[model samples]
Target: MPCWYYDKKELRETPSILDGISFETERRYRKEGARFIMECGTKMGLGHNTMATGVVYFHRFYMFHSFRSFPRYVTACCCLFFAGKVEETPKKCRDIIKTARGILNDNYFYSFGEDPKEEVMTLERILLQTIKFDLQVEHPYTFLLKYAKCFKGDQQKLQKMVQMAWNFVNDSLSTVVCLQWEPEIIAVALIHLASKLSKFTVQDWEGRQPQHQRWWDMFVSDVTMEILEDICHQVLDLYQSTQKETHQSSSPPQKPPSRAESPTAVKSTNSTVIMLSSVQQQQPPPVSGNGNLQEVNNIQSIKSLAGGVPVLSSGDAPSLPQGPTPPGQSHGYHLYHAPPPPPPPVVPNVPYPTSAWGVQQTLPPPPMPPSLPPGPSGFYSTGGRQQQQRY
Candidate 1:
């Protein structure tokens, strides 16, 4: 007969079978979902065992179904709901749904709809059938306490170590160690880690062998010091990874400038003013004797000055001046020069006269000077004439 147990090795080899989600994504969702289970259980006043069992149910369910196939939060809710019933601390589906909604609200990324009770009920049935109603889950909490009592040294120190180890076991649920290791092994490993962290040494209980050998010999032969070390490393790795993730997530984000307080708008306005000043500097002095062309040129110059200044919107940056540096300074600050304003709007001085051919004859507008090439400011003309053309 074929065994019903899943082969973890096979699953690892064919991970792509789980839609397009990577193993890292699956791990992240599992960690978050486990945390949600704990939060929900706490809000509902359920015991620690109930929460632990629920997390186990979640882990087991995901072994067969991808997180992509079913939503993690809904499945997490179903696990807690079912675990409560199996542990004889039955909670109503409605109550679980309410707690789930509250927990999800704490994270802006997730939200619950008007009703999730029906969905929770459906998932609960699927969860129960998945594990074939084998609701008995052996947690490491009880075993941790049992092993902690075996330490023969200072009572106060023992209490602290045990507490630390208990917390470690709780954090270890977020890792795959719980699924891979037995409860006794996990419990012993946690206590060993706690003792090491507390700097507490184990005392020989019996006068059998040396102090070092007695510690391992105290427990069943199945629990070795090597296994404990491996488990400890796994737990520590989990802590380091979680700390890195937390630091990254808690970092401040860069915010863009708002419309009311935009620097670009201020710069653009300043640029336009600068461009107008530069244009004024380039104007030729008024001619002593007046010729029609010179008068026209003077009029054109005045018209160019009168032309509308390029209205720089919030997106435009202020242009820098390209004028020669002062006597003492070798280099001047590089600034963008604004584009030339458009030619002044033309208005007809008089109505067109009709020719003998009965066609209206009109005078053409003066030809505009060729615009200068764009300079460093990305604007046409090194002079402020470009600012006038932009309008």
Candidate 2:
């Protein structure tokens, strides 16, 4: 068989990079494609070996072809479809396409064109050529199991270590580590990593040879501490990289802690009013008529994220700045709208700004109060009523 192994230098610059795709983008695509294959296969009731075979095929195919040239999602589907046949658990092309359609959104499914079946079948031939018809694949799973059997220690710890190693094998598939080392070496490295993490040191084992100084030496004489650690780092980095994304998605960014009050402090400090999310998401910070800096932490802006948002301050309220003239000077919009509308028994024929679907829609005929003098309670009055303003 042709040598499939490559060094880190070569993988760092893949064919996708040469085709104008950034290294980061290409790396992201590889992970997403492998994940797609795994998810699609799981839904199809395919075995782990079948999915692993598909993922390997995916990585190998991209090695020769550019991700810019072919869509990753389509190639992933083709690989899964072909691996099913090679692994003797074939699924129908239509069934696979249906599964993908449900998993992928319209943007990804658009690559399948009018007839997805034809798209996958046509790519199947190119995939075969790229992999050079190397249908026989041997994964680290078998080697991991074979080497693990020799480990003599707590059976439960051994089982847990084996399980972690197996997961490492699965995760390692998403990386180019498979293309850089043989399956036996990867198995040894991962098993060693798992043993160290589980704190189950294998001091004694079966088939102990006098020449071997370490447990791993019995299997691979060329293996060293550096090589094993390198493999371990490569696998561990996958978790750390994804952890950042998970953290970002989990927190859901609380609107960048609304911009602080402008540095300009005139005699009559103009306190800014802010319109936050619907009451269902977050409540506005309690602001008294007295000068108290409203808390800024818990607020999500309803505006576009292009610029800084106005903050809440308790002082003399200022009229809102007029909006830009609407395109073509459309009469449908109001150029100047005051801050939050006050109670009735005041001014009429006023249009307030509201949102329908992100557009600044106009609410017609809402009675709004004109600028009133400050009340004894230090609050602004609207029609003789001191209404507490909601941020």
* Model 2 error, position 329 (Å): 30
Each model's Cα RMSD: 30.0, 21.4
User: Which predicted model would earn the best TM-score?
Assistant: 2
Across residues 1-391, which tens digit of lDDT does each residue of candidate 1 receive?
A: 2123344564453333456666555665666678678767877889989999999888878777876567777888889888888899999887787665544432211223224676778777788878776778889998776666566778877776676667667767766676677787788788776666555677644434553464645654657677788787776665445434433333442554332221221111110011222223443222111111123232123222101111212232223335654322322122122343479456454536753223232433345667766555666654445543352
Estimate the overall C-alpha local distance difference test score of candidate 2.
0.67
**C-alpha lDDT of all candidate models, in order:** 0.58, 0.67
User: Using Cα atoms with residue i matched to residue i, what is each candidate's TM-score against the true structure?
Assistant: 0.59, 0.64
Ten consecutive residues with minimal summed lDDT in candidate 1?
265-274
* Tens-digit lDDT string for candidate 2 (164-254): 6777787777677878898899999988876765567889989999988999888888888899989988776655454343334334354
In order of listing, the candidates' clash counts read 19, 0
CA displacement after TM-score superposition, residue 217 of candidate 1 (Å): 3.1
In model 2, the worst 10-residue window by lDDT is 302-311
Model 1 RMSD in Å is 30.0
